[model samples]
Target: MHHRATTSRRTLLTVTAAAAAAAATGATASAHAGASGDRRLHGLISRMSLEEKVGQLFVMRVYGHSATAPDQADADANLKEIGVRTAAELIARYHVGGIIYFSWAHNTREPHQIADLSNGIQRAGLDRPTPVPLLISIDQEHGIVARIGEPATLMPGAMALGAAGSRSDARRAARIAGSELAAMGIRQNYAPVADVNVNPANPVIGVRSFGADPQAVAGLVAAQVRGYQAAGVAATAKHFPGHGDTETDSHYGLPRIGHTRAQWEALDAPPFRAAVAAGIDSIMTAHIVVPALDAAEDPATLSRPILTGILRERLGYDGVVVTDSLGMEGVRTKYGDDRVPVLALKAGCDQLLNPPDLALAWNAVLRAVRSGEISEARLDESILRILRLKAKLGLFRDPYVSHEGVDRAVGTRSHLAAADRIAERTTTLLLNDGGLLPLDRRERPNLLVVGADPASPSGTTGPPTATLATALTELGFTVAALSTGTAPSAARIDEAVAASAGKDAIVVGTYNVSATSTQRTLVSRLAATGVPVVTVAIRNPYDVARLGGQRATLATYSWTDVELRAAARVIAGRARPEGRLPVPVQRADDPTRVLYPVGYGLTY
Candidate 1:
């Protein structure tokens, strides 16, 4: 709707240098038409009021249905007048620049429902002063971090794709995932986790990362960026500097990385550099603290040395810098909810995401601006970066996507097949002693399948109908189902043991066994019986570390039904466990020696 000046020469070089670096790495940048729409972008920024410009720096979250009482009243009041809830109220009132879609917000099974909600939000943004379209973003990181579940394609996730051991797999995964997001009117993805999960005990980032190899992670990050952006969705390389080495979950508390500068450069920084080289649209800051980079104990999300000095200067990432969810305890605990947004902005983040209260955060930022704490010029810098990304997405031209083709485009047959391929590729076999795997279902069809219960899903997907038992049943195995809750209690373990008494073999599907003592105990209990026990880690790969006695141990890294089916095939000897270990698992007997080093996998 508005046009501005040509992009400065410095900006042009930033684009060219990124492209040149991609070419050197044998990766290609996404071919975006009208990339030179900066003139229009600048005009839009020039026309924006200071409040509007400041709003562009904060991206908040909104539920699809009214979750809270006040929000319900607001929606009902608006729905009465406009025949639809004015999603624009987020823009018209609070002036949040973007909105992150959670499963609750995009909860409907119908693709049209999700698309219509996105369109409504964007149309509302466009109707107000300056007429800028909102950035519809999601955690379509494909796998355990996915925000849009099925009917979207159920990707096997990062570790699975990484286990495939091919950049081609990474590229293809991102492309399919990105295309689906585009079909859903999602413009940005908080994905391509650049974190290298070096810690086996890491409960949060286990399967979210590609693998443990820094070089491989770098290559995969580049490949995924090319694929996702090429598919018309902006790909983010996140948890910058890195979140992989930390054991603490930032969602709950601050995790500090004590790596020296050199240590960080070696262990944590490679994938981020590679992502910048790949011309990634945005890089999400990690909430973890790197004492080597900034001695203040503040996270990269609130550190100038890390965000501006390291990422902006050393890494030459001139693109947008986005903060992780400001609402998380890692950030919120340090900086009060009202102050985190301003700190993130002052620290160099272009977007402050998921603040507790949008109005309070915006007012705080505005107050900082008025007090000369955050310069108006600096605020405009973030606005320009945000606008440039919006322009790259062509959000300015037309943000509304057609609902007619969305159902056909998202979660296509080809996408599902690609997901299956990756899942099969990433299904790693850590140990298969005594030739115990590929059990003949025809012979040992009387199997006890454990951990296939419908646990509360952490991601956006609705309660899954497909479980390990359901999948095993389809494979002609007489799977006796055991539905343990999120954690297997001692009673559940006893039940598993009793169930195993009559079964030919026990296939225990473990989740986060490293953290959940119940799961670890269940595995040890079953293995102690000396019965044929097979362990399959459906969430993280560290289960084998605790229950090394299992005759057959495997990891699928995610609970996507397709991946579960792939794991079943691997167990049945129909599909090979081609996936290698992405993160190292420590031996129970020896901490010095890794039980299974990275890239370890076995096949029948």
Candidate 2:
């Protein structure tokens, strides 16, 4: 059952030579170097213990700004979860193959801090007995889910890029983000969300997905994959088999997709196929269940029929397959914590990401291997994929990155300018009634900016209202701001209405007005004030359909500062709104009635 015995020498040489060629020239390898590289990989695999091989399949998260010297809160969280005080200690204990960074976990504070943390983590892994390098990774999707925030270059999210309808822009954004991540010693990015948002009510992937059109989403996903890999970072096409049509968030519950095999092929399969064609380094499995693919109704993360039959055999994707975070309720609901990792591996996932209990999960897998529940060859197959990816990334040669290059590579003025340009292009002017916008700075000298500043997935609100106010102020207009909160109280709405008095114009930022009555009420009351009202849909463009009033409206698709500033520019006539709706917005009361069709936009 040894890998060397099972894998033909010819196949080994081919793989090793390809990896070497990729590292040396980023091209196909010459046959001369194949034997040495193959020998090295085979020798390493033969020498690896069962424990060491099992450890290679896990990607764990540790709470800390510094891997070696964790702060008190970080230390406590790490100790409680993994029985360790620092990332180094956790890695030493578990021999984890990768580490995922999170801002809430304090793993990414800033550019320099992230570089230091990544270097420290790498040192720990290299110091291990087997001397394997860790794959440092982050969400870094840029707009909403960015773990490494500004002064890291924040690009527009997938939907915004879709709105702008430029594949070149998508590629450039991914390359810029990937280069910055690579400069900080991070090798993998879980980004370019491949899910096509077909269902408008989908709570988790609203603005995260590229769009509802399968072909369009596929094109953008492919572009991002090439872009990230071009910059020496692995790009992950995520939530495989698609999580775009479900109402429930996989982080909370397992939603079932009712797509028949034919429907799924037409709607959800294109982006994944495009990603594979683009040579993506990995594909992350979703926790949602699709009965059409598997009769047992197992989540895609634990279904061999879906992962192996559909993704592996059907799609011909040979890269590593990573599962979505196992800590999520979706995966944990069916099985015990110990069994989830084993099930996922059996289902053909090569990497188990963010298992809530690492020790328990690791031990379970080790026991499964020893008990012959999982064959040695099966385990080795996954190990080979993981190790090959590490080698392809040049981690075997050198895993560490320079601290001096961090500042130069991240958030340069040129990168920031690119972000602004892209963000400006994504500002869709959905409504510009009777020349209400391009507000004359002299006529509308005083402006009031008020409404919901919804917090992003990272729990940082751009305080979008304040950001918009600041942007308007910079355009020679006196602006006052009030944050009515995502779900504004009655008192908050009244205060906003009272404050709108005597203002030359009112700009309201709305976040999902269909869901929040208070936000709709806030907009309605503000419109009653008779000041020319301009509504900006900061998160999703669907708010315009629910606002119940004819006014100047813009959809930025996100509440980030870059997006807010772009909205301001369009209002001041500094920049023309060029973005169209990427996805159709249906009327609030009627799903059949399309209020705004895809590619619909109004420009001055």
Candidate 3:
């Protein structure tokens, strides 16, 4: 977990590109020169025109598999809209200060390929007459919202780490995760979700958060920040003022957090305060509306009081105030794509992340600056914060990564082993009504593994992926497997139930059961078979509530291959279930009637 960071890809690119930059009279990555780096910052800002300065606030996305970002229409469509073809064009055209990569962008299996792509982006930024290396980043929040998967250590999620109940382990998990990004040349990580999942009915921030308790979430978030920052990656504590107590998904529509100022301070702001206290250099604003802080019905991402008054003045946090993706429906739809970026800047955000239309947003911000709607001083303040972060990251010294060391450094065996241990530790067995787990293979020798594959409706290609079925097989069981499609028909459930006929014991895996009634129904049907079953919620911990009359129930809170195998270990008795529930579990129809409250798990 304490592995040294590999050589930077930005450093490698610098040696080759510095000569050209020198010839053009532009500084290399090392633009900040002087004892205090003050003179250099002033010189750079002084030279920047209004357009260039405004451009520094936007952070554009470049997905891995696609030429256009995830939010964009298509490659040609993006070109027609923005007059830019690829990330390279977007960077040049807008002078984007940062680039965030999604799974589609950094989805390569090869570590070197990821490193090269990141290094290329940094090189592009450094080539201009006034050069500042890009803040290459990804939302690698492990578990649920992870971007870098497979080749990298798919570290157990924030809740899993909280379930493991060790701050040191939390730090270790984040460090392992950040090491991968650092090795791959991505210096900024938008992670350490600061939302405290107090509302059991909350849709989005469930397992992504640390826990239901404010104090515990604070400790966990602070620890993760330390771990990530120590590994030379800047960590951003996100969804500020809490995105936890909401029923709506910001990706789709507006979510209103209707807590009083006192309630908000008690439940949501504690974690954010702790994050800032721990020196979190960046905090991403949430899109949900915190009415107590701002009564205008504006989301936190565009609220002056929330971003500037609360986070900046009240909390006394001066680190970067980054807005959540501007493209999210929560804010983007409220103020058309072009207007959101400028509004975000005026609202006191330092970095505008993932604006839907890069050119339009850039032009809007530029216009705002030129028209004096956004002051020049305010522009400098935001860009200066960005430049200060780059300087702190030593991006000015050497911003690129070396491809040669990526294989050695990113997702090494040690990191993966640690991740596996963390996963195993967090695999919570909520129920074992009949000691049905640790299947006495000798007794339950004919093992039948079954579940609904998330991407198995016939046409999609999802990993042929590591399912609990494969995992049980690897544990030396005669695992006959049956996978129903995502939306299992009644017939399909009958078929699955039929498959469990001769099996001594059945292990059913549930994926995202909170939202999928089909998977929940399949579990109920399997229960009707009365095969002494054990249900594992592969994605949602709340799946137990969805399935009634289960012989036993377990929760892994993730579907990563490592977590699947970890669940296997727990089921096979190779490892004990050490995790406690991080969220409260209640009766299916009742939130007040708690069945298994926060910090509840069973082990033999």
TM, every model: 0.89, 0.95, 0.90
Give the per-residue lDDT of model 1 (tens digit) for 286-318: 898888899897878999998999999898988
Worst 10 residues of 1 by lDDT: 1-10
Superposition error at 382 for model 2 (Å): 0.9
Pairs clashing within candidate 2? none
Q: What lDDT tens digits, residue by residue, belong to model 3 across residues 272-340? A: 999998888799999988778998878788889888888899999887989988888999757788778
| Model 2: ten consecutive residues of lowest lDDT | 1-10
Cα lDDT tens digits, model 2, 159-198, are 9999998999999999998999999999999988999898
Best candidate, TM-score: 2
lDDT of every predicted structure (CA atoms): 0.76, 0.87, 0.78
Number of backbone-clashing residue pairs for each candidate, in the order shown: 3, 0, 15
| Order of candidate numbers by lDDT, starting with the best | 2, 3, 1
* Whole-structure CA lDDT of model 1: 0.76
